[model samples]
Target: MKKAELLRDALIAGNTWCRANPEAITVWVEKVGIETQATGEASFMYSYTIQALATDFPGDVDDLMLPLLGWVWEQQPDLLLNPDSNRKIEFEADIISDDTADFLFRVPVWERVIVTKTGGVVTAEHLSESAMRINSSEWETVFDPASEGNKA
Candidate 1:
């Protein structure tokens, strides 16, 4: 798996899991920590610690994380995220909770990230400078035939 694709899938899984995890619904990533682990019998493993605030995580972090990680593994067996891949990605993550919905924000969030792969070590590079801005539009409630004018 490539860097971009790996990040994309991880984001998607996060959003999906959040939606079902109540207090979730919005995956506001606050802190993204990366670490590598090594074992004598095998290669090093990469792990990510993605933290979130109460505002972004309505569900229990402990309860949701295991399943979320499981989903990621099931969906992507060749996950580019493993430490062995010699690859890592970073981004500002929009870092907001009041706006985007679940998976819908992946594009806007990831476009601002940097993916690094070192030569037998670690190298980093930015994906894009593309920024996402919300337009200032007044909220207009359309007529609901199912409800009376005042009820709407």
Candidate 2:
């Protein structure tokens, strides 16, 4: 699957409230840009929007942010690592009503594709951010190192 799809899935799946009440929320992922080099490695930037569709949602719109942020933290640590980078993740929210709102998140993330040739054929394999980690240990939020392995 593409990184955008994985991100959308993770955002929805990570939230217990979203999973339990699927009809109450909606997620849309749009590719913002792409860059390719001579090495065949391409970077895809995506903007995903999560909309609270139900008029009777039980919780505040802000409550839905943690799970999505957690997914980004674990899958794409670089966005959280550098605050001054232009590629940092960003987000905004528009409240449609007291119970419904639209949350748009701009995530500048890239998936590394390692291409190789074997005599007669060439193949490419995509690598996840966690797979390309510099540190072998698990990824932890910079704000709180003690919260390792906790997605939320």
Candidate 3:
């Protein structure tokens, strides 16, 4: 499928998932495009944003989204990590929880596709490292600043 089409589909799926689960207060998708300078190859990346409403629910936002995220990863393992291709792609999902507000914010579910051309043969490799890094950085940014003042 074309990169645009894949992104559109991912967005639609994410929105539907959020709506079906009302605990989700906010949801959106982000697209990241990466291109290689020497190879002139390019790929599109997809991620999801979700925020859960405050309620007495049993599970946290991460708990709910992790499985969904895993499903996406499992369903599209190639898009997650293509080993045979020089092309590289990456994706990540970010989930956040706020005990003070009793709410959760989940953003940036990830997808990436990489394409490379060598000897007229095209290859691709999907990398999850970027996505994981993005999610971790985002999470840290959210909580790290707040935790700074509490240092003993």
- Each prediction's whole-model lDDT (CA): 0.33, 0.55, 0.40
User: Candidates' TM-scores?
Assistant: 0.24, 0.62, 0.28
What tens digits encode model 3's per-residue C-alpha lDDT throughout 1-152?
Answer: 23323433443354444335454333343444343445554755444333323233334445444433433343343333445521333323333333322333333334456767799998776654333323333333432334343211
User: Roughly what TM-score does model 1 have, to 2 decimal places?
Assistant: 0.24
Off by over 4 Å in 2: 21-58, 130-151
User: Residues 1-152, candidate 1, lDDT per residue (tens digit)?
Assistant: 13334433443454554445534333334333343334332222223333332234433443334443333333332332335531332223333455432221221112122345567666444343222212331111111222233121
Name the candidate that leads on TM-score: 2
Estimate, for each residue in 1-152, the C-alpha lDDT of model 2 and write its tens digit: 26666665665675666677766555444554444566544332333332223233456655555655566666666665555653555666667777666666666566666667789687767766663334433445332236564434
Scored by lDDT, the top model is 2
Task: Give model 1 RMSD, 1 decimal.
Answer: 17.1
What are the runs in model 1 whose C-alpha is more than 4 Å off?
A: 1-24, 27-59, 80-82, 86-152
TM-score of 3: 0.28
RMSD of each: 17.1, 5.2, 13.2
